[model samples]
Target: MARDLRFEPHDQPAGGWGSVRSLFRHATNAHSWSRAVPVLPKQNKPGGFMCVSCAWAKPAEPHSFEFCENGAKATFWELTTDRVETGFFADHTVSDLLGWSDHALEAEGRLTRPMRYHAPTDTYVVVSWKEAFDDIGARLKAFEPDRVVFYASGRASLETSYMYQLFARLYGTNNLPDSSNMCHETTSKALPESIGVPVGTVRLDEFDATDCILSFGQNVGSNAPRMLHPLQRAAERGVPIVVFNPLRERGWETFINPQAPGEMITREPTDLASQYHQVRAGGDIAVLMGMCKVLVDRDDEAREAGAPRVLDVDFIQEHTHGFEDFISRVRASRWDEIERASGLSRQAIEAAATTYLNARRVIAIYGMGLTQHRRGVDSIQMLINLLLLRGNIGRHGAGILPVRGHSNVQGQRTVGIADEPHLVPLDRLAAQYHFEPPRNKGLNTVEACEGIIAGTVDAFIGLGGNFVRAIPDRARMEPAWRRLKLAVHVATKLNRSHLITAETTYVLPCLGRLEVDEQATGPQIVTMEDSTACIHASRGVAPPAGPHLLSEPKIVAELAKATLPSNSRVPWDDWVADYGRIRDAIEETFPEDFKDMNRRMGTPGGFPRPLAARERRWNTDTGRANFKCPSSLNASFDADDDPAVMRLLTLRSNDQFNTTVYGYDDRFRGIHGSRMVLMMNADDIIRLGLTRGGMATLTTVADDGVSRRMDGFTIVEYNIPHGCCGAYYPECNALIPLSHYAEGSKTPAAKSVPVRVSAQP
Candidate 1:
């Protein structure tokens, strides 16, 4: 073995001195004392900017220190004193910059000026916004609306997303795909049909009352740090927190609050996850369905004996559909398959079900672990099926919580950043703007990649994300993405997406979330919708990174003005001048969702958007929640053809959030100085003839002719399920085929990629 990988496990609890040390270290890395010091107090508080990280709900009564360790890292990473100018880009060619890693590129700091690719020299040069907008608009006019895709990240606020989507729809394309399509689109897809809502129904306050929590495929410590507070509290109250994941994550073990003086003094950690079952990758459906089957059997037993029924018979009969058929199918399912798939015995499932039956309210939480699979949609629906057996949905302290990453992913989707024409209110949008909107269905993330590869899509307008890097099939995306006729990115910092330039590509500098955005109407506040359905205001505290930087709303408005020939009906300048007018328009268009958005945004914690599930009112075509069953309980890909074939899942480092790699050291996992190490079960290491610290190369086990492989990954034995392994994201995205996606939602199956790992060549 050429490389010697360290295998030191972190024995300390999550979020203690470890988090405190990491916070200061990250701050120092970003030179936070120079800019972030002042804004630290203002983050997640009233009249302050939101953290541009995970969308964990801010408590109504926040602690003195409102932000989490990683949240501060995100803020500091944004508020860095470093700046990139025209000379920097002039010195580096596209090919030269492509050699740098994602972390190293972001480490160069924020982009200071608008830039356009000079294809002759293969470098970017300073360009005036007026000329850039005019030229881009002219070029875009040459292509059909359907050929251009308007992509967004979760960093964009509601106002920015709304204006951006409005501009795209008016320009005659419904091709508005955002980050949510890649992350939690399964939640949006499953919940709407299963519970008659796209988002979960539980409020932040109601979470305090939950007696039990069943977490699936989510890591609370890294992805959503603030969430550890509630989970810690629940643990202390004797809540049975059960976790079903491929790996025994550090977050599922223990957490010590850095903010708690007693804990900091005593060094005692709260034990979390009373029962942690290491379910196999892509086995979430089987495990969840097994729990549901146990509940059904218990209910029947109680009914036959004339005892109290285990199931919520009344709620199921009144609010849901397909119960009888679903139960029958579940009962018909084989136990051997369930155990083989979930990696848990029949007794384990029954025990988990017993804990569920004992609790009055339960909150089922999940993340990409469940959603990024071929059966992602089915996995999520099965989660709903588990909750439905005991009437978990639409109750206080009980509901499905698909914890989202990034600050405003759900907010962007809520404001019409969707590819589906029916999902967006095209009529209301056109009626408000005095233009007939296009009703054609557009491309999602996968479809956009297909469009780019098939040479059907020629242009891409990206708003605040590294779209090219975030999606699956990077081997194809990078080359195909570079061939675009025109690509425009509205961003604050330099990302790999900008480097993969199109024939005519522009990187437009924009204000970060913490930066003051002064406009014709003075300073403006943008709103973001968190996972809890609360739409709150974010007021920036720091000055703009550069004088030339524009707010997202202004960038979109200017683009709209230049692209659409200055229509009086649209009034792009008017909306940018006063953001309140945008809120008024949003209220006018979706009167039910945002009844008093303008009035509520100014209030103390803002207000919750109306969710039909929260009020137990089904909004489906049949006006009822639905129970669904998968074609088969075996959710995993067939790996019997090769003994070396194992399910591979992509993981986020402790330092990174999504594609943004803050640092190479994954502190929670005890990983240092590397992100390309593979986590595997010890037994698998022995069975595959691989030693600890050995180098292994992973190749995709797909039927496609294309051989996707990544080499020279250091192996580290860990507590993962048998026949399953783990690797870092975007880097490992090469192994995931673009064609491999959820059956319905089309989300990339990142969690359960079948791969053959052999000794590195």
Candidate 2:
């Protein structure tokens, strides 16, 4: 538990001595200070391991310390000396462990041995590796492949992800759902349709040449604090940085670089965002359209005045399609509708457009803020439309950047962790492995949860992550999880998902990040892909917590061997002995994307995977950059016209990453001790007849027959727009229904939940 739980104003700028102090405290909490000291300098280095946090690209020339506060916390949390061995599990039953908080369960430390659930005892008992593998194989053999679900998290290495997907495919099921389905699948779906690229186009070095940056819906200070260094540097260069979010994030407000001795001595900070607009949640499309409208209006004026054209007429005429229709749609969009839907004045939108037009080389960036909406795919497409108008894609120092979570999250998708069959190379995989892969479309995260609830999914094999806890509608998903006949989890630590056991459950312990992984061919180094599609190698630094722990590659190989027949197409044992064999296989499978991957693994800053969009090559059906405009600018804005409903947007604490809660304190937001607090505008608080610092209950206003409730949340006054509220995620996730998700992508609309808050009895 946190030392103290309280709320107070945080007046200091982000990432100065405050981050250093926080890192020191967290370092001490990693079992001890000395335990975390040795690995601090090695993180994000060439020969060292990648930080198991955000997917922010590593600079070619990294600083002395490449880690940020979030990275440090992740390092400490992973390397903690505390161990949850067989004795610990023996002492606590599954029912007893279910009552523990997420932070408390993780604080018990790493898992040291494989365990199997004993049904009568209601506790987990130690199981041999061979026994667990054989049983899981036999159980999987008994069920139809469609009844099984293979789930992976973003923390998985690209090699392991490739093997996992291959194993699932060879087993006659393409039911490969991963963490990306919930976060950046919208980007994956939208970008390719618009610009014929599935990933962002900007490189890390382009930041220096970028004259202006436009960011949306990302809370950098909490999710990716290391990004502030670049933002601070950009500000120092007098580059204009603009932001649009529902809340005024501290990272956008100001930042004091901890590495800069001058700033530390003077106690001064650099203002990051030159113009910060607090746009309403689910209003990204409206705001982006509003900006495009302003640009179009400016272009009309310029045409009348005979001055310079505001839009790139030649570029659009040559490289783009559907411009006239997109322009007509933007022109038809009324200012009153945009202003009302975006919770901003028309003048504010115009001012932001002026900033956009003033700069030649611009980069538009976003996070889950633009996604996780009813129209998430449309929202991202709208952003692409604005970028296309100015010909931002493939331009020097200008492109789109989607800040992804998890170190290799984007890499996982690149390596075949996807539900869509076309996104993965079927023929090449079949040719490489000498086996036919599953061709049918598989279930996504939400669909998998639905299948589990309906008893269609009888078995679940998780390579990593707490799937049951990370999804929406926990109240409904938990019981359905237990209904499964076989449940398997490959994890590093104990989590709630492990406690909700199936009739036959196995918890397999694997090596954590940076832990030494010795295989038949010396210590193995795994490769991971960053947000910018840069692929780099990561090697282990720390010793394994226990001898029983196996590397993910080894565990995956053994499982693959155990599941398949005596004569299998894959040489699982050989691949496990040397991960290089797997890389060679990947090279053959993806000749263009990972061309000569094995030889290039030793590059100084690693190598970039080929991206045709970076050179403005269109891979779309039309052979040109396509434009799309939604009929309405609002995303779930008119979801419910009920006057009592307020938009509930879930967020993460500064001390937290993804579903893992490191501490109760939210450093940037100034809340401590607990996560059960709802942030609301003062006027909305009064309108709802709620008092600041008082308790309230939130009930979802979903069309689904089921009801969701989040009870006893402390009310705190915030500067968010009216009719919108914010709450900490994984806790407030209870208030979101599984059915309420982005339409095309099926990504959980966790950021735009509609709920009503009232006084708690």
Candidate 3:
């Protein structure tokens, strides 16, 4: 048996260096860090250096230092001291690189040159830029554009993503898969169907006016730390912030602003969440339904009497449709059933509803936790229903904010990286570029992986991202990657995906957003869309880390120039030479309300992209917002569950972002030095007859017998609900079967995997 490792709790005051150090030790895998040698800028113009971490909009206020811990880590990783030139590849085989961990490979330093895998030698060899381009062009010309997949990451600048989609469409394919597939694709899919828009309805400034803020499953401090300020301000204003999650996150309870001198000096922190409810995993849909049912019941009683209706009937009548049907469904839902499913008492539900009813303005923010469920889309729709009851959509301090994960994931979608079968953006490409693009619907991330596994996808081109590690079923994904004919990655550093080499693989290093890119047309400005659909220009302040590092836009342009025929009217060189021209093309292609893309993006504090919510204008066919009834009430839970299996929820460590593991410590959870421990309720352990520190093997109860047996996992009894178990993601991703995903969103039900756990022998 593995030794029971015990962690000593520290009572140091929050915001103190001791607390910070403790958090770092636990979250960072206790790794020693060499302080970065700060590089003073030669020029201090407001260059476009966007934070590569989160989607927090760049504030109008100018500060001496304005970077979060994650942002600084992103910057350092991009501008690291190490370099992996051709010589490094000469000493390592593809097989050897495969054996190294993702962190170890990237820690070897940045890739400085183009290198290609030689099948005979089983090693990567240096290739000149010209030769590399020629090889890519030849391979591209051999297949129809639909056969190729163009995947982009959120880190890619707006300028680069726009050019990438344009090039792919001009080459006659809508095979544009992206990172959004992994995170907020549900928000994009569900919001449009319900509200006629695909973005957050509230602006950042709206938080100031909000009376009550409800956050479901979003860890604001770790994912988007800058949001802490707005949340803190809301708390200062006496607004009640309610949080509902399966686990208790310290950041949500109280936060000490690292930026404020007073707080930093005194080690004082402000209380954030007034009420924290630990809802069962995948129970959000039921909880939301209960809230709506309460509202509906109250409104019906009010209508029966001479009193005014509790619901905003005017807003429902004027701007929304199908409210009557939605109300009927909400009223029919049983409170007893809702309570059983949600694992929250009727008093708790009523208290939460009372807060919402009393508040004049309310904002509900959520993260991937709400979306990574079987009924993810339905859950979002229900949240919309609750907000719509009070007409919160277009109000100052009220709306829904789907906190997106990547820096530029929203930007990629804005620039047409989509697989919408009906609205492929290819027809618009044809009208603008005078070429008929492919009309066939393209593959999404899941489909792309399946295609690779089935041997239909011969070549893969990643604009940016660790595709293999990010996807589910890694055991299958890695082998599928090996079966590919050609795999190419345009990246800033090495990652797990690079190790999943094809027969012939190429690693082309690219410039980071913070690094300057000098092209034939001179320095360029990149644009990015924030979570609120605000588009802003980003300029690189520092020099490129290496001479061989190319900008993503320039790389895409050059690749297109090499691949496409001379007769193609896309103007690849012109767009690469000047990003403004690319913006002009984007403006021409998607002629929406705001078309002066370059000029508007240059404005200070940036400008909000054209959205119907700003003006309460619905773009739906009926010209009004629509209300949707969930197809089924028990959509989130399994209809037929084995009595032995319990649902597992996958989460991230405070120090980690997505699949990027900065360290092994989760400070907020009081976890240190390891991520192999599972959090469960004490009652649950007693009920299952499992002891603390007992090793458990989790197996998914799927029909395919595709169970994942993770051994030597220590069980730590915690405050989670009885029926749910919590474990860190990417590590626990193996327990989530890909086939058990949401029907409409296709999002992996990472938050709810029905699994059976027993003591490991």
Candidate 4:
């Protein structure tokens, strides 16, 4: 399965001619494009299906074309005509299939029926859904609650996630860990401590009123294409978009609106960033602190001159605490240290800060680039500090926005799919369901993997993600999954996770967002919360790929009924029949957040959830927006100290979404027909004596005394910061150690792995 790797430097902006071509090609490859093309217009429409891609908010007024290239690709990929029937598995054994690339494995198409792994033949055999549930129930009944781990994915709806958490709690364990634990868990943990809320405070329409947008560490164009719309509009309206990232992404510089007829015909793309700064990997804290220093210094000068106060004095006195301590740390930070750590000159940082100070309304946007680091929590806090210092929060057109990757990852967390048992009030759950929910915190993604390795885990259930592929240290995690007594996955298509089997394995095929989910009552529509905190209903208009496929709620409820006793107080069957009942339970659990969930979802545009941070009503321990000052303002890594070791950042390709591979081509970054490639700085490539398109092996640097290496990766000279390199995730995830994580939030340091690259042996 050798691929002919191709690289062509792309000068055009993202979402112009290249995006249109790629969209059609992928849609055609998914099967008959004509049959699935109609589904695109319906996506993100009022009461229509939501894009399975990134969770950017659905436009208030639906457009004729509502989806981006990747969003269309997801709809087509799910509505693909290629079915993985019994014959497909019979022809390809699990051992044989493991050798295939991720694209090839999923390209075989949608799973048609429930499957059970027959270890003797090494092939998946067909099984009844009832039989599968009964088997899962038998295993759960045999094991202690603490020994079972329940995992959730971002692709799931809020209904499914609530059902999943409820099932896990009713089973007597709080072992609920989802995809959030891997990506934005740091934001979830740090924002509440800093600003009295877990999710971002800005509304979707705030982009229109924002005067300046400061983006940090995220490739906005590639990760969420729909976001380019608002950014483009902002740029056109004279809004200054200051971007800070390691690589020069085409999306950050310029983007073409595919919806514009003149632009599509002329191929004229709009410039996105007014000023772009290449902040080195793991240098976000330094860059942020430097910006804060400039702001504080300006504020001091303004006070001396008796001009308008620059530091939001009135707001600080009324709504904030610990600002004095934060300012002291910022003022004491030396310019030389900030410049050295941030890989940016003081002049550039000061200029950026000047823009921030001048703007009346500002929005700070960040992604995994800020979250996946050794000091990720500190980096997030520093960003919040900048916004707080200027009183950007709780105002019109200004706040903090964390760009969530998954469609409903935020919604899942909102509805109680988390490792922390106290995330949802347990007393309410117990009062409504008539069962005592567990009080102890449970295993998150990382801890769950460790628990499996330590032989403490007996059963593993995945709601809707490629957990093994998405998590770090696959060499250890994969084998640990095999040791589980039982493993269950509720999925729509075949993926690498299904191949990694346990003693008892079941793959229950479920409905995709674009497919109609007909239950006992009738067709059901699920609700999801977008990144901007808007809750909307998503109803599938197309027919199911297979008649046997069940909705995620049905699968979860059947399993609950099979596992729990007859006297179990939860109304699992009624909830499964109509999803409205599930929302009723959610309202009971989260009365303040989801009051009248059904009614709100019926509106043209869904209701916005209450954000205390938006109203300056702080929910922190101090009852004020707390400024968390770091002990030191230095970068986590030393650039001058480690010339031989380049920091490796794990990223997603333009054609990929999370762990799902749409294709091997990363057109925006000039990569083609390969996923096993690394992007390195030209200077570092020459220093390592490596040439473009040459093979290299990466060895992880750790103090644990064990060596982990990923062999045979092709290196490409890229426009990146010196001493830093980048590679796509799930491929480079193995090089990340589970122990290497942010101090407070245990998120894997995927973006900042110290690795030594050498010529392949």
Shift in Å, residue 291, candidate 1: 1.0
Q: Write down the TM-score of every candidate.
A: 0.98, 0.99, 0.94, 0.98
Q: What is the C-alpha local distance difference test score of candidate 2? A: 0.88
By lDDT, the best candidate is 2
Please identify model 3 stretches exceeding 4 Å from their true place.
Answer: 1-48, 62-64, 421-425, 639-641
Clashes counted in candidate 4 amount to 0
Evaluated at residue 533, the lDDT of candidate 2 is 92
Kindly report which residue stretches of model 1 are placed more than 4 angstroms away from their true locations once superposed. Answer: 1-5
In the predicted model 3, the residue pairs found to clash are: 26-665, 27-665, 28-663, 29-664, 48-538, 48-539
Candidates by lDDT, descending order: 2, 4, 1, 3
Q: Which tens-of-lDDT digit does each residue in 1-761 have in candidate 3?
A: 23534544433323336434643443233221332214212111135467777887656553445555555555556666677866776788878888875567777767888888787888778788888888998888887677788898787887788888877877777788888877788888888887888888877778889999998988876677777778899999899998988787777878777657798887778988888888878778778888888888888788889788889988999999889898888888888888877888878888888888888799999998788888888888888988888898888888899998888898888878887646445667777878776777888887887788788888889998888888877766788789887888998778878877887788888887777778787888888887878777887767777887778887888889888877456787788888889889888877683488877876666677878865789877677888888866554557435556787888887667777766555666767666778778888788887887788878777787554667767888877887888888777766766676776877777888887788887
| lDDT (0 to 1) per candidate | 0.87, 0.88, 0.77, 0.87
Give residue 497's error in model 2 in angstroms: 0.5
Clashing pairs in 4: none
